[model samples]
Target: MTDSTKYLQALEEFILLGKSAPGAAAVANIQKCISSPNCFVFAELLELPNVQALVNDAEHKKWVEALKLFAYGSYMDYKQQKSAASDSLPDLTDLQLTKLKQLSLITIASTEPHRLTYPSLQSLLDIPTTRLLEDLIISAVYASLLDAKLDTANQRVEVSSTAGRDVAPGDISNMIAALEGWSASCSSVLTEIEAQIASIQASAVAQRKEQLAYEKLVEEKRKTAEKDGSKGKRVMDHSDNTGFGLGEDEMDLDDGPFDDQGGARKSRKGGNKMFSRKR
Candidate 1:
């Protein structure tokens, strides 16, 4: 068989295997089909690797099948190499194309095509988004089969090569105009927001300064009160000392604790003589 035919066959078989309830032989077949570089591909295909033995088990068989599927597809497409651009590129066979067209028609009938709709046709295929992106990137690739067809048709219609060779000039102009208009509005909004932010920052700074000033005033008041309190204590201490400084007041002769200094002297002499006689 031609390489193309073999690739087409492998693609269909891979899709079939992808949907099956996984077993060792089935998983191994899938691995052989896909040629997985890591266990993750095996894990994903089988849905779980718990059944696969840790060291070397029959689960490796699943990976073998997966590898075969992967290899067959990869060998056919140069564009599918070393990239996550699966959605961008599609390896659709004639039968697959027919099915896809039918699916697309159904989608259009049920949903608006030009209303910025997401692709529902892919969901029907149960295509992973990773693969979908790959296909889209491949589809959008410069001068792929689809674009070549368009370019060929354009060349047939237009005598001049320059005519419609690039994006339509008017379309680009309109897009630029829209961008400029949006940019002007965005710039104004940004300016207003910046002004508001600046005002808020200034107000916060002023409030902080006012708070600091108030704190300072309160601190000064506290210090002054403390100083005044200390001074009052000092004055009270001086007054107490002065009151106790003088000796006990002498008894007044008139009050008769002693009649006079002479009487006090005679009493002392009598006491001394009495003490001597006793000795």
Candidate 2:
């Protein structure tokens, strides 16, 4: 298996065996495990029933409570627990103090919005002075636990982002469910977009087909009109040629089949004879 699997297996064995066989070795191993970079492992170990049993045992009580503070509790929890205890707690090493400060920031981030006031954060961390708190925040920022801006004028810390932590037991399923929901939402939007594109494409194709059909009809009408116009022009030309000759023949018939001078003389003689007969 992978290194993570091996580490987890090793951690599980330690937690299970350490409960039945509590000693300097087990406490040392526990200390080593909590000091690991993986904060979730420390959190997971804190949740064990056997680990909680260490609270009653005077030898490992301080370590158990310290681990709890790193897991989910803030500096306030550490202070409060220390106040209630009859015995004196062990002094925190430099490394443990740094880790506690980091964990305390995480706890604060969980409750507050992006902007966190210096006073409130100082109260939670129980730092002696503002300078120390600022230093702690700076260190946490350097460790990449938080992305924050210290607004001295406003006396607030503005957090823009935070790094992801390890998943607690049974949290993986919830994370998967959230991811599946997001994927489904994205798929739905994609489907709607695809449908809209198909609709637009269909409309364009129909319009193109209609335009082609109209153009074809117009072309056919133009050809038919040209043929009809040519036929009508030929008929008009033939009628004009025939009408010129026929019109002259009709004019000659109207003149009574005589030359122009002879017709006039005969018409005059006919008029004289009619006059004599009347007399």
Give all candidates' CA lDDT scores: 0.39, 0.67
- Estimate the lDDT of model 2: 0.67
In angstroms, give how far residue 62 of model 1 lies from its true place. 52
What's the TM-score of each model vs. the native? 0.32, 0.55
Off by over 4 Å in 2: 1-22, 29-58, 76-95, 128-130, 153-156, 170-177, 214-279
Candidate with best lDDT: 2
Instruction: Tell me how many clashing residue pairs each candidate has.
Output: 47, 0
Give the 10-residue window scoring lowest on summed lDDT in candidate 2: 270-279
Top of the candidates by TM-score: 2
What is residue 162's positional error in candidate 1, in angstroms? 26
lDDT of 1 at 58: 43
Instruction: Write model 2 residue lDDT over 49-74, tens digit each, in one string.
Output: 66776778888877776665565566
